[model samples]
Target: MRISVKLASICLMLVLLLTITTPAFAATTNPVLSVTGTTVAPVASVTPTTATAPLMPGDTGTVVVTLTNTLKSPGTGNTTVITESHQNVYPPTAGSGITTTRQTQTSSSDGSSGACELKFVNLLSEGPIHVQNAAYTDVGYLGLGDSAQFQFTIKVDDSAADGKYYLPLKVKTDNDECYVNQVVPVVIDSTQPRLVLNDAPSKLGTSRGNIIIDVVNYRSSGINSASVIPEGAEFTFKPRAEYTVGSIGAGEMYTVTFETSSKNATYTGNPSFVLKYKNGDNWHQTAPLVVGMEPKTDAAAAGNGGGDNTLLILGGVILVVLVLIGGVYLFMRSQRSKK
Candidate 1:
């Protein structure tokens, strides 16, 4: 009975020893192996920047495009399970003991793993828009949360109408792994105010005379900084350089007068007038209007000549009457003396 009790105590101690040492052996024998999973694809956001909106036709400017990688680091977790079995004999006794142990350890990491490679970037020109620069190639890699900027020079054709236009943007990666095709919108504004010369002086006298001109705005929009510039080869005009008319509303009419005199008595050259105004932020001038100016020198000279001739004729008649009356008085005196 004493032997049985001692054996039982010895077995209990062996079991406790095995339990403590088995965990330490398993920890050293097994190591956590990290297995990387598939990486998430990168998605880029594109933003375009322009200097001005509603650009006028025949304008040149730059377009800057920013590409941002919006993808984040991938999350990963790894788990390792270790199973160990051991057999132990305490005192070479008939009864032996067997022990089994299991250990589990997990390791994880949430970090950046992937990047975006841009092989080519291009901005294509469409109708009435031309690209002035070459396409970009081998732009390089962009990691998560990374961004890049590309600048392009562009020009709008002079014949482009007033409307909205789209420019195609092409982005590509190696072996066509990632491709993106998008469009950027641009506005074209080519509207201009229309000005017409309604009326102008048809004749000018030799002396200082008034040159009246009627200006009419034909457009529905208002025109600012309205002015008129008169040009003549044979005449000198008031406000020799420019005549400011201020502003004119839609479909409005404004009359301006200039004091002018002919340089010579006969003006054979044609006179012209130009209308200058501003639309939005651009200044425009209309084609010169050739106005006919007839000089009144011939009529004035004829009237003066006729008046001088009439005065001479009246003087001659008075002189003839005086001479006849003198002769008659002298004859009557002679008759009276003879009587």
Candidate 2:
């Protein structure tokens, strides 16, 4: 009977030890306790909603980009995936202190990967507004539950045609093959005429010279009565003050000649031509096209030379008179000495 009781006591100790250790084994074996959260792909969206345009060529402006993170549960382990997915995402999170590289936008239409890409770059001191093989500015690091608005500086190509043109914006993450191509509207000012100083004479003749003026109508509509107002006191033209040109077609060149003359011998000033043109019954005038006029005349130099010649002639007469007086005195002295 005593042996049986000892066996029972051993069994009871085994049961107590199992009760304490069983909870620990269950905690280690249960997979739910090990994994605290779930991980999924990064969910984010970038939209270029509004664009401001009608900007002049050779001018710079800004484009706004809206970024939002739509991820419900962003995973810790997938942070790298999220960040790498938005490698081209721009204007990194505040204080994240991340720097990104400038990239070019490529067109699948042509096989030239980044060569002919249209991209926006920092404006250099001297260069074309649109850099070759580059497209839009990259805004880096768009994160979950975060919204960012980024302003991108862009330049309109000087040679870009009037009317609305769209610049393609491409956003992609290196981690995935997904990319978004958003087109932004760019409008070039179509109403203004580009008045370029095509040609001019180096020197205006004393009486008259031909001032060649070119009216380049780059607008869609033609211009009428394209004229130049040569307004200055020092100069005069055939017509009182205005030189009228008939009409100029769109994208056409009209060369008008003005018979300009300088009034004074010594005139050193800019002879300005105010460009006046009419478009659809509305008159428009451009800033003065000031041409440097330095009147060329030998008359001024000849007048000074004539004064010198007069003084020389007077000197020659006095010299002749003095020689005669000396000769007479010498003859009188010779006669006195002989007597």
Candidate 3:
């Protein structure tokens, strides 16, 4: 009877211990996260989505990025993924020019959107940090019953150089490769003319001096060379046309180096002929060349040497008219006396 009672007591103790420790063991053995109290079910996975236009030019309207974290398991905390920031803007690159890098604090929600204009870059002061880059701040994982989504939008630099710009975004979860790279093609465009004359304005003379034309790619792809028209002013050689850009890509500046023969035309008015290139469309702009001519006659030569003679001659004509008027008055007075 004593043996029986001792065996029964041992069995009872084991059962009691199992009851107490079973729950604790189960808790310890469970995975890091557990869905308790509520039912757990699987849902559809989230596939990445890309924008129609990877990026928007400063001149081209606006770009909006819609990130759908459609995963059923909502993340615990919201994450700030920076698509682009001119400066350290937590979100997108501010349209702000180089004078001031776009900052998250200065985003459209707070500051004026005009601050993001790309035209204000300080080319000489200090260049903006270019190429592609990305980062993520402290954020949380998806919670059991919650969801998080972020909308990324930014104004592309209208003047942004054309290149393969790679933008990567980091999703909060490490389980899946959440990084998605969006290859953005930046197109160069401008309402203003792209071809500009960098040649010194003072160097223009009646004799066609060497003219340097800096050509910018506003549309389509890069131009290999700009084929000029006419034989006299614009030719392939003699002046030796040189371009800053030999192999120009989209959003690039190519320079044209060529010289003109001395201005030998009869008329001395504005001598402007259209600079044309048949890349695809008829691209043309009036080349700004100043033609200086030495006058042939002594009077014309003297006029050139002195202040504007045209104004002086007008003043002299006015003086002569006044003297004639006075003489006519005196003659009339003498006739009246005689009468």
Candidate 4:
């Protein structure tokens, strides 16, 4: 009986020892993975820096995005983050105006057994704007106090008008479920100068004369280095071939006078008026304008000179007949006095 009691006591002691040592071994081998007191709260943000300025048609630009993780400890494995963007219509470089949509992903963490993530950002344009590459970019991995940057290539639709576009972006993390949304503005500066003829003379004489022509700027922007030139072979100008107009503003007008004459002998028609101006760094010309013209002609040579010569000859003949009659009368008077 004593032997049986001894064996039972030994078994009980062994069981207790195993229980205490097993936990200690486990504590040493595998560290606690979960954050003790503070949870991993990651923070993220996005910036559309390119939107501050304007983009012209066929212009290529970039939009930047930044992400940061504020986690206290590394808890999980790799976290997936996605960034997505969409626009109402594609750029003009594309065949036609179509919808643009894109997505990208990244894995970010706090390092040392932590996870990292990236998310999609939605962007839209009021005008026709498109994304060339994927709308979103992958940052790969991000650690604690670590920041990641992504760049997106965007194109302004070639057919987009001069205007502003509002694009909103959404950022999210797959692991933490954290999200942020931001809106950025993009301006389009691809407006061409519009020139129109205003307050122009209805008629211009073919003789060497000066006439005023008003060049109107009908566009929303200003026209610089403007000039007007007559575009007809039948007309010539004095002082200069082209008249200088300088600059004109939207809804404003500038007038210039050109000394012009007809190159032809006799002609009556309009003279073409062309507007040349500078827009941005390029020069442009407008459609030809036709003005009324009455060319000089020799009316006297046509018939009036011959009619006057005939009248003069008839008068000379009548005067000579009167002179002869007077002479004969005087002779008869003298002869009678002598008798």
Candidate 2 C-alpha lDDT tens digits along 26-120:
11110010111111110113222432324455555455545444443432221111111112213544323343333222221211111111122
Show the lowest summed lDDT stretch of 10 residues, model 2: 26-35
List clashing residue pairs in candidate 1.
Answer: none
As for lDDT, the candidate ahead, 1 or 2, is 1
Query: Following a full C-alpha superposition, what root-mean-square deviation does model 2 have from the true structure?
Result: 24.6
lDDT of 1: 0.64
lDDT of 3 by residue, 168-285 (tens): 3333333323333233222333322255657633323446556556666654443333543323342222334322333445576666656544343232233232344322222333
User: What lDDT tens digits, residue by residue, belong to model 1 across residues 118-232?
Assistant: 8888889989978789999998877666777777777878778988778888877653444667776767766544434455567765677766677787654566788999898
lDDT of 3 at 107: 16
Candidate 4 lDDT, tens digit per residue, 213-249? 7777766556567888776666677645787778787
Q: Which is the leading candidate under TM-score?
A: 1
Candidate ranking under lDDT, highest first, comes to 1, 4, 2, 3
Candidate 3 Cα errors over 4 Å, as ranges: 19-66, 74-136, 139-185, 188-267, 271-339
TM-scores for every candidate against the unseen true structure: 0.50, 0.36, 0.27, 0.42
Which candidate model has the greater TM-score, 3 or 4? 4
Off by over 4 Å in 2: 1-191, 194-201, 295-339
Candidate 2 has a TM-score of: 0.36
Ranking by TM-score: 1, 4, 2, 3
Winner by lDDT: 1
